[model samples]
Target: MTKTVQLLQEQFRHLRMTEVANELPVLLRNAEKMSWTYQEILQEILTYELKRREEKNVEKRLKWARFPYYKTLNEFNIEEQAALSTRQLNQLRELNWLDQQYNIILLGPPGAGKTFLAIGLGIDAIQRGYKVVFSTMGELVQLLKTEEYIQKSKVQLKRLREADLVIIDDLMYMAMDQREANLFFYLINHLYEQSSIIITSNKGPEQWVELMGDQGITTAILDRLLHRVEVIQLNENDSWRLKHRSTIFN
Candidate 1:
C-alpha cells in the first residue's frame, strides 16, 4: 500500500470507520475511472460509510433483542389471518404507536402465530432504530428473581427501561408464585406509560384472572396495561407448528 493510503487507513481505523477504510481503495479507483468531481467522490464515500454504519447499528440492536427467530412482515401470511387489517398492519410498520406508548396484546390459541407476530414487530422496531428486548415471560421472571437478591435486578430493570419497546412472548405458559407475580408486576409498572410493550399470550384478559391466581393484583396489572392498548386476537383454527412438524422428521 502507498504511504498516503496506509495513513488514511490508520485515520479511518481511529475514527472507527472500518467500512470506509476497507472500501476506500476500490471506491477511489472507481472515482478515477469515472472522472468524478472531487465533491461527487466525497459524497459517495460519505453516503456509503453512513449507510454501512446504520446497518451495523441495526444488526447490533437486533442481536441484543434476542428474537426467537428472524421473521419479517413479508414472511408473514397476512391472507391466512384475515382478522388483522392490512392497512393497520402496514401502519404498525410505520411504528408511530411506539411514540404513543401503546401496548399490543396478541391473544390466541397455541401455534396461532402470536409469537411470530410479536417477533416480527420487534424486528421491525429494531430496524427503525428503536431499542428492543425480547424475552419469554418465564425467562424474564427468572431473571428478575435471580437478580433480586444481589440487587442486580434494579440495575437490570433500569437497562430494560431504556428500550423503546419490550416484547414478552408466551406469557402465562406457566403459572407463577406470589413473588414471581410481584416481580412481573414491578416490571409492568415501571414500563407502564414510559415504553411500549408487545405481548403474546394463549390466554385472553378474562382468562388471565385465573392464571394469575390473585384477582386484585391481576386487576391492577391489567388496568395499567389495558389503559392504552390494542388487542389483536388471532383465532386461526390450525397450528402452523403442527402443519410444519413433518419438516423436522423429514
Candidate 2:
C-alpha cells in the first residue's frame, strides 16, 4: 500500500541480483521475510535457481546413468560389482576405446560381469556422441552369415568401417566354422586401423588364435586389436544370478 515500497518493487524487477544481501532484503518487506530464516529463503530463491540454469547448458558433457555406478569400480568381492583398485578403475574410466584408435578387451568367465562392464563402456561412448554397435557373438555371426556370400555384402562392411566402437559380447562360446570365421575375419580386417573394438569373452587373448584358426587372418586381427589395447581381467568367481536354495525351494 505504501508508494515507496511499490516503486521499489517495480524498478528493481529488471535488475538481476549479483549478490543477495544488497538487493533481496529491501525488495521483500520485513513482514514477508518473517515466514522463514533469511539464509534459507535466499539460497532457495536465488542460488539454487541460477545453478540449475547453468547446468542445463552443459548437460551433454555429463556421464550417463551407468557412469555414476562406475565411481565404485571394483576388482574384488561382488556385493554389487566388487571393489576395484584405483589403478584398474582409472583404466576403465579413460575408455581408450572411445579414442577410436585403440581397442580393448574384458577377459573373464561366465557370470563375471564381463558383459555388464562392456555395456557400461558402450553407454559411456554413447553419452559422448560416439555410435556403438552391441551384439552377442552368435547373433552377430548368424546375422552376418544370413545372406549368401556375395561381394555386395561389402555394403554391410561399409557400416563397420564407419562405426566408432563395436562391442562383441559372449565371443568364446563356440568354435568358428569356415564361413563364420571368414565373415569374422572380413569384418575385423575392414575395421582394422579404423575403429576400436570392445569385446567381452570367456577366453583370454592367447586362446582366441587357435579358436579362430587361419593364422594369417588371425594374426592380422590380433595385431590391430592388441597393438593398442587395455586388457581387463576380472578374477571374481561366478557370482552373478546366484539363487539361495532356501528361498528357491520355499
Query: What are the root-mean-square deviations of the candidates from the true structure over C-alphas?
Result: 2.1, 9.5
| Model 1, TM vs. native | 0.92
What candidate 2 gets wrong by more than 4 Å, as runs, is 1-84, 147-160, 236-238, 243-250
* Tens-digit lDDT track of model 2 for 1-250: 5676556445545454333324444436542766657785665557644654445422432321212233222332345444446566566657664675788788776777777677666665655566566667776677678646655444444444576878788778777877788888888878777778888888887788666767766777687788888787775675453521146452
Please list the C-alpha lDDT of all candidates, in the order they appear: 0.85, 0.63
What is the C-alpha lDDT profile of model 1 across 1-250, one tens digit per residue? 6889889988988998889999988988899899999899989889989999999999888877878789898887776676687887898788888899999999888988888888888888888889998888887887888884656556555557788999988887788888888877887999999999998898888888766778987998999999999999885586766755666453
Q: On a 0 to 100 scale, what is the lDDT of residue 50 in model 2?
A: 64
lDDT, model 2: 0.63
After best superposition, candidate 1 residue 176: deviation in angstroms?
1.1
What TM-score does model 2 achieve against the real structure? Answer: 0.60
TM-score (all chains, Cα) for each model: 0.92, 0.60
